[model samples]
Target: MFKIFKLKENGSDVKTEIIAGLSTFMTMAYILAVNPLILSACGMDFTKVFAATAIASAISCFVMGFYANLPFALSASMGVNAMFAYTICNSMGYSWQWALTATLMEGIIFILLTVTNLREAIVNSIPPNLKKAIGAGVGLFVAYIGLKNGNVIVADDSTITAINSHWFTGTPLLTILGVVITAILMVRNVRGAILIGILIITLLGIPMGETKYAGGSFLPASPYFCEFSFSEIFTNHKTLSDFIIITVTLLYVDMFNTVGTLIACAGKSNMIQKDGSIPRTREALMADAVGTTVGAVFGTSTITTFVESSTGVAEGGRTGLTTIVVGILFLLSLFIEPIFGSIPSAATAAALILVGGMMIEPMKDIDYSDYTELIPAFLTILMMICTSSISDGILFGILSYVLLKAFTGRIKQLQLMTWVVAGLFVIRIIIGILS
Candidate 1:
């Protein structure tokens, strides 16, 4: 086990890895609930989607552990699931099976790209400063999600967003207390501080009515396995055109989302080499591709490396052992649905907020004096928080980087593939405007 994980070389041990895995699972287990609820709106069975989510997540995480040997976890992505339900199925008026077909195609394309190393090339093309910015941007993005989840922030019509007025009571208050508890534990050098905080807040919420136990059958219904709609997509010109657009959009979003997340979590784990590259990147990316394909087969959205994996890396996770432990917990969650389902979002929000704080330490590596680098880097971090999309954050960064370089007579500093990527982003943006 030690030899397979290279635990010593990675500066981690089994105990640490286990704790890290628990922390990560606690942070992301909300996906089990959230994914089903979102997808059910598009006329799929909730319990079936829930089962598929756990199964696909477990498979992906295991592959990541054994094949990629990285401390990362994969699950149905929140953004892509929203697109799958709200855009592809609802707005586009396609069946859920048709959306699954698009997701399958995207995953297959991802596998092909990984096999040819084009995905790796895209990662390599990102400049050092932009990479640092992406890491920090992900930090801000995660922290924002934590705040929103804990009700520390609430949506407002006039101001756009505001602090919850009733934050002193209910879930928000418990969330703040949990943050304090976790912060004190960290300061005192407690192992599994994040995990402990989650459990503590969950217990406290019981008395405050913040945690509700809605018991249900533990057995999951069978998923919509092997259901697809290929002929409907190819029959007519309009349907074919829509299919191409939907597939391309899914491909674009999943590609960059996976890239950004892998970069962020890899940076957190200190796994990126000095040359702005990550080892086993192709294998790790292939794990994501495989996850997406398997998810579609099982009737779910695109499964990719989750940014929440940062929670584990922040807890000293360095090797695949951490990932395997997380996979185990996901499987266990299937039988103990009520217990896992009862874990309130506020209970895990503090851990995410704290991990985000840890992840931003890499920002110091950015070159602050160079406007060409500084502005784009700043925009990357700012837009991630504002737009709540990592891919969009990277899109603006790459576009701005290219524009600034070209206009400032520094085009020679930009790589060829960077230009190509920037051009693609521009085309995607144009397509969005037109459609």
Candidate 2:
């Protein structure tokens, strides 16, 4: 394991990797509960989808660990799952089988793009400032998720969003205390601080009545294996168009989701080189590509590299050993649902918020005086928080950068692939509006 992952070479050891893996898993375990709920609403069996989520996540993380040798985890993406259930299956009147078919096509396209190095070129073409912006934007996006999940922020009728009125009470208060505890631990240079905080808050929640003991069958049901609807998808012209659009949307979303997350977490881990490229770019992309294709076959949404992996990186995970640990835990989760299920979201929310705080350090590297650079970077960060979509954040950033550069006679500074990316975003917007 040491020779394969080069723990010493990556400045990480087995113990640190284990703790980091635990931290990553703690923050993302909510997906086990959430993904099943979302997919089941669209006619999937809850228990089967739950099992599929766990298995697919384990498979993806294992690939990422052994193949990419990165500390990242992979799972059915939250937003892509929503689109699969809410848009493709629910609103569009397509069956869940057809949605899986679209996900499969998206994964295949990702593999082709990765093989051709188009994905790598697109990633490398971004300017350094925008790269930093992606990291910073991810920070805010993550923090926002933490806040919502913990009920630190609540939806309001008068205002679009507001602080929870019961903030001093149950879950929200526990989340706040967890943040303070974790922050103090961080200041003291404590190892496994985030993981420790999650555990501490979970214990505290037991008395607060926020954590409930769940007693039921732990066994997972069988998935709808290989149950695709290819004939239904290709039956007629209108169905074919819908299939194409659904597949394209999934492809576009997962592409940027993977790219933005890789860039953000890579920046956080100091894996981005002086030339602003990540090592093992092909292998990392392939992990995501293969993960998605396999996930669709297992009856789930598109799988992508998770941003929550940043929590593990923050805990000093630098090697694939950490990813291997997460993969193992995910496999274990299938048989111990109640154990993982009992941990409240409030316990993990604090860790995410703090990691968000840590990720913003890259923003200082941006050249503030260059409006040409500053505006796009600023938009990238702001839109991510406001829109709550990584792809949208990157789309606005790239479009603004290309437009500003072109209008200011600095178009020559942009790469050919940058222009190509900008054009693709434009096409995506057109398709979105038409659909």
What is the lDDT of every predicted structure here? 0.91, 0.92
Model 2 residue 189 CA deviation in Å: 1.1
Model 1 per-residue lDDT tens digits across residues 1-435: 999999998889999999999999999999998999999999999999988999999999999999999999999999899999999899989999999999999989999999999999898899999999999999988988999999999999888689999999987898899899999999999998999999999999899998889588877567779889999898789888888888888888888888899999998888889999999999999999999999999999999999899999988999898999989988888888898888887899988888888889879999999999999999999888898999999999999999999999999999999988898798889878766
User: For model 1, what is the error of residue 393's alpha carbon versus the real structure, in angstroms, after optimal superposition?
Assistant: 0.3
Worst 10 residues of 2 by lDDT: 215-224
**How many backbone clashes are present in model 2?**
0
| Local lDDT at 7 for model 2 | 95
Q: Model 2, range 145-214, lDDT digits (tens) per residue?
A: 9999889999999986899999999989999999999999999999999999999999999999988876
Q: For candidate 2, what is the lDDT? A: 0.92
Q: Which pairs clash in the backbone of model 2? A: none
Model 1 off-target regions past 4 Å? Answer: none
